[model samples]
Target: MPKIDVNKVAEILKKNELEPTLLRRVMDELRLAVQPDPGEEEKPPPIKKQFVILVSDPEQKLPKDDFVGWVLQIPEEDNVGTTPERVCRAAYDFNDTKKGSLLPVSTIGETLENVPAKHFKEYNTWVKTRTPVLVVRTDNQIPKEVVETEHF
Candidate 1:
């Protein structure tokens, strides 16, 4: 595991406009959560797993032939942003990348309701654009060709 840098944590919190006083409380709670008590047995891994999917707008009528791969969120710069020189940075934080990234997303999980209140609008917009539910999987999991056959 990597060491947690307190200064980096503080910097991130400050950049997000969070109060410094909350840092100590969070660190204490996190420390206890990660430490195991004496004689406590290790828990087994989860039997079920959840996944995340990226949805794009179908209204744009993008070509699907060349679209293949995993999707990653792209961050952009704007004025009034988290880093003051930029603007409304958080506004575009959750915005999906262009539909032409040539990648697919695949994973299913319950709608994430724990998103911060500040990102509600952007999150909702994504929810509304359920064009292609791209699936993200390993190279072996992806078939070399999507075959089509005719039946008599």
Candidate 2:
């Protein structure tokens, strides 16, 4: 077995446009030098892609006359080959009408590709104020003669 630094060997191969078999030989030798174990099969690297549009509850503000629906796209490779269609969920606001069509709240724990469409009504933290109560009492034992105090 020969000792070779993988990075140095790679640079040499790249600089000379040499065949990789020499580099592979050094790598295999280096692997064997450490533990001298059976060769294990190499695993394929996972594919990385990008996600597109993700809808939040505030953006779905559509006109009262129309109905709305949403859809999402998930890469089949990442989903373990499951061909599931992206679905957007919308619930009625029920604020303007008595239809009770209010939609459910939409939360994003992860990416939009995994979350289904969700409808959410608005939320308000509004509160009202009230005046304190006051009472005036007249005692029954008051004197018959009324004495008026002078206002200085």
Candidate 3:
């Protein structure tokens, strides 16, 4: 097969004004398509695990009748130790609720850090009855289809 000039392809994509995210997706697909299939003896790729990080005011210390919780999806591959801090920083940056603001990372560390991460399937079963206030993908590991799914 002829070699593909990736740089030229990228230049063409850029000239067409393709969005960066779309360009990334296209490149990923191209890479996948070009990869050789593994032999039967070779092990399959590892299955990526999804975790749910729930940030909420469980004690109702905030002065609000209905405080909404933040639910974020992170890949298990992320640094478990620093995930809480990342979540806190994201919450601080993107919070739009009328409920009380998120406590500083230091103050909320005990609450967020201690909360156990739940597998996506397990969390999905548990959260069936409840509606999420805000749900976001904190990592790029999750596929676009999963992120865009109605249930997600």
Top-TM-score structure, candidate number: 3
Scored by lDDT, the top model is 3
Local error of candidate 1 at residue 63 (angstroms): 62
Better candidate number, 2 or 3, judged by lDDT: 3
The TM-score that candidate 3 achieves is 0.23
TM-score of every model? 0.20, 0.17, 0.23
Candidate 1 error regions (>4 Å): 1-11, 41-152
Clashing pairs in 3: none
Better of 1 and 2 by TM-score: 1
The lDDT of each candidate is 0.41, 0.38, 0.49
The window of 10 residues in a row where model 1 has the poorest summed lDDT is: 106-115
**Poorest stretch of ten by lDDT in candidate 2:** 121-130
Q: Write the per-residue lDDT of candidate 1 for residues 1-152, one digit (tens) a residue.
A: 89776667666767787655787677667667667797898899979733445345445455544443322232443322223211132223423434312332222111122222344344322222223334433323445798676873
Candidate 1 is scored at a TM of 0.20
Model 2, span 1-152: residue lDDT tens = 88867667667767887668876786677556766356676669988643222223333353424232223234435452331112112222322334322433243212122222332212211111111112222233557898798974
